[model samples]
Target: MNTTDALEAFALTWTGDLTYDVAPSLSCHEVDTLATLLRALGYTAAADAWITKHSRNDDEGDAHYVTPAAALREQLADASDRTPWVELREEEPDAFAAGHMVLHAGGRNRFAITEQCDRPSDDPDRT
Candidate 1:
């Protein structure tokens, strides 16, 4: 299969697997790659949706924590049933993440979940 087909097949494999909570935290590079691949595959809507989902807020500043809203959180929690290896990481300040739900999935580090917020509670209380 060609690159585009391969990507589509791969994406299809993770159909139900793609969700807010179980999503992966993508770096700037990963986002670019994903967007490019999606567009190349003619999945423009999907690409746009993915980017919009992961986009960060303009006023979020350089560093901040993000979390999903109630409805999305509920969906994510449900999605975790199939993909149990999901993780929610507080990304370091970077070019991506417009204060959205940063997810790490399919062994990839770049993917965004929508309905996010900037709040101190969004971070892990490791301290």
Candidate 2:
């Protein structure tokens, strides 16, 4: 299959697994956007809907956490069951996380990644 086709199919496999409480693998901007969306949806707190939402707001500058609102926590947990951001790490122990710190110098680390797949085969004779 073509690379795009394969990727689409693989994505379809998980898109159908929409578990509620799970958090999405969001970028920094996306975390912000989710807060905005949740706000629009009547979910309270930027902390409420920010799944991968995190920051160093602590006075010591060492604090980091994502506090989905109490109402949304169950939904987020359901989402975790569906898409499960944490599952990628469990399945991919050797996957390159880049840098040694939990969060890079910029304080950003991917909160989720979809299940890994074999590299697209380029050798016509091999597959």
Candidate 3:
């Protein structure tokens, strides 16, 4: 399924429960799509944490079997309220503002966001 469909399916079915044991099982692609959607909705930290837990190798076993960190759970809970999931469903992904972060999954499933350098340079020497 496309990312939007995946996202809508997740949002519609999610029970708002942060308990890992109760968390819904998702395919690797679904996990990637959810993480990408979360990042698009500006919940980068939660997305990163969720992806980190779920993207382990098969030998490592599924991390979803364990409870998520309290902070991660809190982040997810907060994000659920703040994210415009319904509105996003109605809009195309391309409609996101320029430089918005998008998650890309690859070998080993590392998380990366395109940096939007709107703030002044951090290096004092540069100024």
Off by over 4 Å in 1: 1-5, 14-19, 22-24, 56-127
TM accuracy, model 1: 0.36
TM-score, model 3 to reference: 0.30
CA deviation > 4 Å runs, candidate 3: 1-19, 22-24, 57-127
lDDT of the structure predicted as candidate 3: 0.45
lDDT of 3 at 78: 48
For residues 1-127, what per-residue lDDT tens digits would candidate 3 score against the true structure?
9987886566544323341432235555666777677777666765665565554322224543333323343444445446534111111254444333333233333222333344555655331
Clashes of 1: 15
* Residues 26-118, model 2: lDDT tens digits: 444545655565455444443343443333221223223423232234443445555633222222234444321111112234343232224
Residue 43's lDDT in candidate 3: 60
Question: What TM-score would each prediction reach against the true structure?
Answer: 0.36, 0.23, 0.30
Ten-residue region with minimum lDDT total, candidate 3: 84-93
Q: Which stretches of candidate 2 lie over 4 Å from their true place?
A: 1-24, 45-127
